[model samples]
Target: MKATVSWQQALTFSGKTESGFSQTLDGNGETLSPMETVLLAVGACSSIDVVDILKKRRLTIHDCQCELEADRAEEPPRVFTKIHAHYIVSGDNLKEKDVDRAVSLSAEKYCSVMLMLKGNVVITTSYTIVD
Candidate 1:
């Protein structure tokens, strides 16, 4: 839960996590901006929940991908106003109902990032299963 950000030069920084992971962040479009990182965090967090939930349901999952589209406010803060998560799931004997339930559960109950932004962000989800 602990991390540090160091100035790298000219609107760029290096972030190191407690787990020894690091990433480069830049505001000059050389790397992912702070806003882009937030979008990525939400997508990755929810996708992890979806994958875990499906696995717990005994579903045979071969691959899972989540595509996220977000709209930000026009003001200076530019907070996310809306987000849509489109999940592409590939597996054998994948039930549509299971996928639906997994995504619903992740958004409503499991994904912390999604829950944190629930009140302010309009979040929607959909899925396609490839057999």
Candidate 2:
């Protein structure tokens, strides 16, 4: 879990992970802001867990999308106050109980990013399965 960031120019940066993945981050609104990247990480982390869990259950999954919403404190170091991840999962024979279990397992046990923020940030999750 190692990464680095290089200054590209005024308030912009090019970030890369040791694994060879890279993304552009900017404070001048040229790309995703640092805070926005955090939210994206939370969503991406949980969604991957959900999809993997569902697949391991032998469910036929077609698509998975995580929509995130957040609130930030209106003060210096304005950190996240609350966050929500709404998962839209499409598949065949996807039951509510299964989806619920997957979401719960990710929030409570699997998603590292979400779990790390549990104490400092209020996190909530919901899911919708379309067949």
Candidate 3:
């Protein structure tokens, strides 16, 4: 839960977690900006939930991918105003209801990252199941 951010260079920083993981981020366009990283995290977090839920259902999953689209306010701070997550799940004998439930559970209950932004940001989700 603990982390630190150290300045590396002009608009660049190194972020390290207490668990010994680290990441480099830059405010400039040279790399993934802090905001961009957050956007990515949202998709990753939700995707994890979807994968876990589907696995628990014993569906023979082949792959799962989450595609995210976001909108930001034009004003200063430029925080995310809206986000949409599209999940592409491939498996045998996958039911539409199961996929829908997994996506819904992730967005509505799981996925702490999405839940944290639930009120301030408009979060939406969709999914496609493929064989």
- Clash pairs for candidate 1: none
**Residue-level lDDT tens digits of model 2 in 2-93:** 99999999999999999999999999898999999999999999999999999999999999999999999999799999999999999999
lDDT of 1 by residue, 1-131 (tens): 99999999999999999999999999999999988888888889999998999999888899899999999999978899999999999988999999999999999999999999999999999999999
Return the lDDT, model 3, position 115.
96
By TM-score rank, best first, the candidates go: 3, 1, 2
lDDT of each: 0.94, 0.96, 0.93
Task: TM-score each candidate.
Answer: 0.97, 0.97, 0.98
Best by lDDT: 2
Candidate 2 worst ten-residue window by lDDT: 122-131
Indicate the residue-level lDDT of 75 in model 1: 94
In the range 14-131, model 3's lDDT, one tens digit per residue, is 9999999999999888888998888999999999999899999988889999999999999988999999999999999999999999999999999999999989999999988889
Model 3 residue 99 CA deviation in Å: 0.3
TM-score of 2: 0.97
Candidate 3 overall Cα lDDT vs. reference?
A: 0.93
TM-score of 3: 0.98
